[model samples]
Target: MSAVESSARRLPLVLRNPSFGRVWAGQLLTQAASRMFQVGAVWWLVGFAGGSHRGLDSGLFLMVSTLPAVGLAPVVARVVARHAHRTVLAGAAAAAGAVAAAAALLARAEALPMAAIYAVGLALAACQALFDPCLTTSVPELVEDADIESATGFELSTQSVAGLGGGLLGPLAVDAGGLPGVVAACAVAYLLAALLVRSARFPHATARTGGGSPSDTAPASRTLRQVLAGLPFIRRVLVCFAAANVFTTAVYVVMPLYTRGVLHSTGSTVASLEAALGVGTLVGSFTGARVPGRPVAVGSVCLIVMAAALGLPGLAAGHAVALGALCVVGWCVGVIGVRFVALFQRLVPADDKPQFFAVMQALLGATFPVASLVFGALGDHLSARTLCLVQGVGLVPVALALRWAGGRTDAEELPGSATQSPARAREAS
Candidate 1:
């Protein structure tokens, strides 16, 4: 096990690609900032609203942070695809930094209204609409095709590490620096993410484009239409992408209920569950380098494993059992998410990556509020264990459907996709 684990820690190979290293480092900072932001934001909102309708306030705030960004994704994706990833990403980060700074100032003054805070959250989310896709799509740009998976793994690992740190340190940050300090810290993080990635090149930005000519008056509508043109392909091959996001979001919605009501555990125990999952995910991100299969297929298989693992929490008789099951779930999340995203990077046209990711993100965001409300409301009447069971069982067919669709579409699109060729295919139908 030790020898196998040592082999999995191939951090040097990825870092050797300086461009990728900078992007990876920047990604880590931004991801950590996101966690910090969430912690600080949730705490502040909870404090401000007090007891009554606290659930509504918290859920609405969380949903607001994500939903508004969806409408802006198509535009964000278009910009990212048309311009250099570095430019769009840096700009977005700078914008977010500015917003965070303003929010920090408001927080320091204790003048931040819920509306203002929600607006700032919306602004940050909008910036992410641009920054997120560029960051992911830029990975393939920075690394060689053979190392794409590693690069993708490195990216997901950033989230795991951030999650661990954010959930752990967020409260401490709030107590030490207060909400203002946390927001300020996030500002600094965004700025750092921008500065780091600014020097990185985006080779894929040079792909075929309708713009960039000196004489041509590039029409915005035309560019948008071209960007939206990839929807058909995305729909056919990525049926489960949105479903996966919904399930993952549902887990977040359900996790707390399970901890408090079902396990009769304290808040710290909820934190522990998140920490366990983060650790498990971190391990998976590195070791999954040897997962040994096509990313789409491997990802599909991992989803099934994750779904199975999710079902375990429902049956778990105690905290330890549930904790172990969550770790398994996290491992699957780490492996499968990277695989699916790497496949997205590989299969989509270099120019259309921004569009593809944006649309998907938008769709996922659209569901965040709906899923949160549905789960939150249902949790009132149904047992958390029952909810977990339903969510777990529900995902199995989605995984299978994704796998079957991928196989058929990939085989049709790529010549030798009989093995894992489906992922390599540029377009299906």
Candidate 2:
């Protein structure tokens, strides 16, 4: 058997299955490459900025990079539903590769102004914003409803593996080539990913029995008013999602500061810790996929555990002890990440999936800037340990919120709508 098939055979039944295996492999490589680019980009910025007087912090740069994606996600979502999912994805991947290549060239010439970087970053985000829903929507086509949970879990596991590889490898590219090398590495990865994902053969979209074409059978196209009407469900999901983002954002911003200032760890140690989190996430993805009933509850527990784990360093005897605790925290974070997306898929309407997912992404995107400001202030006032402790404490309300949301929904809410054509076409009926 080929290596991919042999690897599949060694996995669980769901993962070993033919169709799901391809989807899983595609996601695994894509996520790994994406993270590699992220690290590479950050390294590139460090080189480009090149001075004690450099204006933008990495957190702020990331915030700017993501904000455009959030704002434009609705537009991206509409594009995904209007065309073949893979077609849209392939195009986006190609666009991403082109942007990465351009960024690399610019970095080499030292012509990579902050504005230019932000513009490229915006283009990259636009590509990624549609990626989640497109892939999630494709799952129903690839596997039966009974197999979806397993498929979701496997996808999450793949992401964790990718995240780990990207995390470890990204910094190395930066070390070797500085900003230019990092950009080249990211461009190459994106090109490879685009090629791999583009080549995969997925089932064609078709209407159900007795229905017309899937597009024609889709719910009437929503008007601006109708689209806005989806706000309630969107709101419910966004609130909890926003809360979770806040918690994670705090960690993302503070983790580096903690290692550098408090733990006195090296960059290598920090990268390893990140990879550890990916490993934890991979483990959590499988467990989450297999867990029955109340995906939100599982997520809640993960949030609580992640929150508690952050405080483990308080009991640590030294830096090494603290690093060990951070590793455990990373595992919890990974599990929560998988559940975060799964719960959204469970809750949104099929037709509204793109818009709703966009809203969530917008909220998530918004939170980073907010966290930067909030934690930046907190850092000024408190010790890094105290800041971590406060973040842990803040998660209590979020954990409670998840528990509350989990109990409110019916089993068949079905995240997507029945129709998803041109909003005007949908409205004609």
Candidate 3:
């Protein structure tokens, strides 16, 4: 093959589109900065609490940050429906940068109270709640239909890459110049993301809501009705994803206990397990688009594999086995997550995409914090191994249920199917 052919084969088709490439680059920076901000803020909060009620403070901070996804999603959906994709993306990024900069300035002056930090976190989280769904909905508009899956795969990979980047960079920044350095770094990232997105083109011709469309002027009630009408097709998959998150969250609660109680290990072992999981997720993200099948079916299989991986650590007698199991869990999650995102992109109408993704963010976001709390409470009464086994067993039924519920033909899942009226489609768009 010629060098050009080899290069074409090696590169992701979506990235060849300059507009998408810029937007993707912005996503990378924004996500990494978000991670860094999370790390720096949490670490600072813990230390500032002086080890008294440290866990409670940290937990509350995380919950506060997450609440926006659930509470503000409806409002965000409306905002998204009324604005251009590029406008929303750029504005959110700018808002995040401004918030980070304010936090950094306050921290430098030693005037950063816990309450103030919480407020900053809430602001940043709200920005993210707006930014993420808009970005997800923009993918199809940015790339050709044929490249959507590959684009989704690349987008999903951003989290793993950001996780690894933040894990490494967060500590270095903290060590070099403490919380101020990290927050400053985050501000720079957010601003850069804003600039990149501001310059990128989002074609208005294919847009569903903005550009003075009738749907842009539609009442919130009608929008809600449209979203509700489409729920039955996707609810099963959403439930399955949420249920799987229970097991995933349990890892955070159970891993430390499992390490100390079962493996008789230390913090280094925990770090190793985390690193393994991150590496596996990175690998899985790159490969997810290549796996051939209907996305929903493939995601179901991935959920099953993930459930088994979660349970494996409980049955393992050595650290290596547990490590391998977590790696598998991460890989399955990465694959299934990409598939689900791509599936939603295909299934949802363009106008309803924002609301759909917001609902998704809320569903997935709620699972982690709530499940972690429940698992933490349970850990007080149960062995880590037993809890792991129970979580694994619990997800089997959810996974199977998703497979059963996903039996509808692809035609039925689209917007203008027999079950939907032409008038309703027109109103929705």
Candidate 4:
């Protein structure tokens, strides 16, 4: 009972750390604000336009929001790497708050043009490029190495909560608050995120060190090397992802077809599995965060199990069985995600962490969609179950390869490091 109680309290205890809590709260507010803004903006555009141009407006809005983040990623990476993580994040959030306030004012005055809306959306995406890496890189600074993995799990789970909430609450917010009210809410949220982050006390940021201070603002540059600092790390990560993503992409493409063709079910039935998957992921994240062990081994095992779970729906089983499989898959993914991110943080140098994250993001953005399209095309003639089976069975070797490489990487990283954490050493052995 005492052991169980301690495990239960780990999350709450971690959350109570003033420094980590501040950053965590800021992340929660910012992500919720982001989801609220994205959904509300899209809905507003479709409602107000109410014509053939609506489709074009919607498409352009997505492209504008997505492309700017990827395009401006290198710049954000440089700023996060060289200058100061805290400053970059807080400044970007504050700037976003200003943009949100301006949009709210314009909406209230009935003078907000579609073009202006696109511009604001693009600006907000750019802010995200700054926020994500700054937060990831600064995690090690906020807590001891022992707590980093758990800290990461809690951080990511916040996004999942916001994603689920944003979908449910976005419509309600717009209905109750109006366009102006929604935007105003975003502005307040962004401002609060900024304030929370700005007040957090980070030791590295204020340390008396040879580098002057971690918070010492250096001018960010757009140099070739700085732009490409994380290329090697990106390559390594993508190699692993490439093997795993085929299975994931297959699941997404196959889910719909399996529901209709195999289960003779409706879209609502499919949604139930997806929802279960998400809830399972949230539950898994908490567990993943608390577990202290070899990340690579843990992540690889989860991936293997998740890959196997993807094929369960293909079985001529009932809907409940399929949903159970998906839940397991989601839980596995949640665990894998936490470990993968922790490994990446441990692998990359602090100054290069943001660049590595940016490259990883860009590669993921481009890769997964194309893989889905390819898989969707395959599903035209192939049975979804067959596809799932093949990929699930095939990806196990890839997971093993990742486990091997992870061990090697840990061994290589520790020898050069000034401080070696036990997790790294254990994995290396």
Candidate 5:
């Protein structure tokens, strides 16, 4: 009874802390807005623009939109290191809102060109490139050191929930509001997110370390050399991340095609399968927060499970089994995401996190688009079943590569004779 009562009392304490609660809310709103806007954009493209509603193709548009952000990430990261975090974040939010507004207008005109849509995606991505580093680094300021891990868990959970909830809401909103309505709703979410950041209970900008200003007034000078130093760790993580993305992207390219072409499933069933993944992600996020061992090991398991889930459609004797497999895959992806963030936090320092994260996002921009392009082209020649089999089999090599990358120790180590955190040391050896 004492343990149960004690646990009950502690849960509220975790939630009630003002700083954690505020940041948690901010993350939730940001993710919610992202998912809704993303889904709505795809729906608009397919329904209004006569494009495919599939994620891989739609993801191309989204990825192209984000390219500028990826291109400017290193520079923006340096700027973030010199300026007030709040100032940059507020500006980023405003810019993102503007992009969303542009998207809304284009959809309303019903004359949205692929080029025009891609342009909006670029603007939105750039704004996010600036905003993300500020937010990730803000965690230390919001809570004491002891609370950082819990805060990470809280942030991950909120993001997962927001994504799942907003994804569910997006189609419903689209039915009621049309393409224009969907964009408007997303714009509102961003605007509200901006306001929330401005009023949130974070520490003063002066207290923060990263996200420096462009004017170069601050003492934390992160030069190209300093930034370059993070490459080894970055290289290690990217191997895993990129491989996983390629495999996943290849599989997703065929899901709808397989659903309709092979299984003869209804459109609604495909939608349900997609939504089930989102729900799985939400569940996985909460569960990932409790993982006891190393993050990479945990992430690896999650990734492999996701890969298997992706392949299940090929092996499942029927439609119902396929749906179940997809849901499991989705849950694993949610779990992988939380570990991904924690891994990022471990590899980079407080000041350079944005820059490093930007590198990752940039790779995402560059790689996924190319991967999608290849997969789309490949689909013309390959059977969906054959593609799934290849991707599933390919997962083994990719996983091995990632594991090897993570385990590889450079001849040189971090400067200052760093005592690696338990997490870092695990893979380093």
Candidate 6:
């Protein structure tokens, strides 16, 4: 067996690598602070609205923040391809810190306008869009290939852990010192992330050159065409990923509505459900790495489970049932996230990683605002339970498509597959 296959069943040991450890630590701080920032900003926006249409205002604020991802994907991809991974990482973090610091100053001065808040949110979101792909592409350069899956699992877990921290601490920060305090805390966290990233040494030269020698790096138009032509598997997987995100986004929108309309509960119940999800995802991130199987196959199963989890609350109206279902959904999400990302890392060529990942991030980022708007509008006419059922049913076909695409791609990557030579297939696999 190959080293990666043999080590597949072992626990993730990537943290033992000092470089990866530093990057992971930075991720934890940055993401946690990001969540805290989101919570505080939303709260402030709600108060700023000071009307019955506060929800509309907050929603608009979030939608506008995500606009950078959709509108600037090509620009971000070019920037990532041209810059060193560490440069992108540190620069993005530092830029975000500067924006947050400026916001804190404005808030403290009691001169923060809605337009300024919106601009700050947009700038921070753009930084995140750039930082995420750079970080993902840097992992293969930091550790042994065998540890990539484990590293990805740990990375996915950071988001869950961060979400929990932000959810729990953000309100407390606001209560104690208000929006300025939370913004200042975010600035500190982001600067610390930049410091950690700047300190870590990436052993591979490719990390410095952004994955290729200057001669190998093509122009943006050629690189885009090359990714589309050479990576059919990534293309197919991205389709599945986009489809699954529709339901994922639906769940986010539906949960609050379900709590209010179906369970006759308050926002506290929504918080409990979110807590349950975070816990489940935390467990699943670790567990997924040790469960021995091909990543795509395992991820297909997780998608199936997630489909069921989305539908369960519709069938059972109890709050306990809803929480349990959401927990299952979260678990599945954790597993699928690690598995698919690992698959992408393995399949995508080094020269193409940035652009492909940039596209993936942009696709995911765009899905949230569009899907949220669609489902939020639907909530006005349809019952929350019905919307949940529709989302669940919608995902069934997506799960099947993922399985079919994965199996087909794996077959194509095997020796003697109809589409590729044995040597090329070996390299692809």
Q: TM-scores for all candidates?
A: 0.68, 0.70, 0.68, 0.59, 0.71, 0.71
Q: Which candidate ranks first by lDDT, i.e. highest?
A: 6
RMSD of 6: 6.4
lDDT of each: 0.69, 0.62, 0.73, 0.68, 0.64, 0.73
Estimate, for each residue in 1-429, the C-alpha lDDT of model 6 and write its tens digit: 888756654534544577888888888888888777765565554433355544444455566666876887667768877778888899999999999998899889986777787788888888887887678778877777767888887886677788877755664566567778888999999999999999988887364445556667665434655776756766787888888887776665676567666887544565576677788787777677776566667767788888888888888888888888888888887777776676677666676776677667777778877666677567667787988888888888887887787667655434235755554443332
For candidate 5, the 10 contiguous residues with the lowest summed lDDT are: 46-55
Error of 4 at 328 (Å): 8.5
Tens digits of lDDT, candidate 4, 1-429: 598667755766356468888988888887777766765665455444445444345445555666655577657666877777778778988988999999999889895778898898788777865787678778877876667888897786787887555534443455566678778988998999999999987765544224664356754534325544433433454677776865674554456556655776644554565566668878787677776667766777877887778766666567887889878887877787777676666565566665556566676665444545556556555676776777677678778877776655534344345467665556432
Q: Return whichever of 2 and 4 wins on TM-score.
A: 2
Candidate closer to the true structure by lDDT (higher is better), 4 or 6: 6
lDDT per residue, candidate 2, 1-429, as tens digits?
899867865677444565556545556655676667655455444334554422135555566556755576567667866787667766766777788898889888886766776676667666666665677777766665656787776764565578788877776676677667766776776676667667765654453123455567566655434654544433555677687677666665565556555766544655666676666666665566665444566667877877787766544535665556566666665566565576555444467666555555566778876775577556545666887778778888888887776566432333234543344222111
Which lDDT tens digits does candidate 1 get at residues 1-429?
597656755557455677778877777777677766765565544343355444445566667777746777557656876787788878888888889988888778786777887788778877766776678767766776777787886775576677797765654566567678778988999898889889777665556333467336633332424654544444654557667766766766566667656777544565677777788787777677678876657777887887877778787757887788788887887787666666666556565665556566566668777666666566666787988887888788888877777665534343235555433453332
Candidate 4 vs. true structure, TM-score? 0.59
Q: RMSD of each candidate?
A: 7.2, 8.2, 7.0, 8.2, 5.9, 6.4
lDDT of 3 by residue, 1-429 (tens): 999867875776645677888888888888888766665555454333344444445555666666787888769878887788898999999999999998889889895777887798788888988888788878887876767898897887677887767645654576567778888998999999999999888763265443675647865533534775655757666777787787676565566557655787544565566567788887777688888776767877887888888888777767998889888887887787677777677567777776667567767888867765676566556777887798789888888887776774344456656776654332211
Can you rank all candidates by lDDT, best first?
A: 6, 3, 1, 4, 5, 2
- Model 4, residue 90: what's the lDDT? 88
* Number of colliding residue pairs in model 4: 0
Model 1, residue 136: distance off in Å is 5.7
lDDT of 5 at 199: 73
**Model 5: per-residue Cα lDDT over 56-157, one tens digit each:** 455576456446555775688677776766667767777678778878887887866667766766666677667766677677777667667877667645
Q: How accurate locally is residue 364 in candidate 4, as Cα lDDT from 0 to 100? A: 61
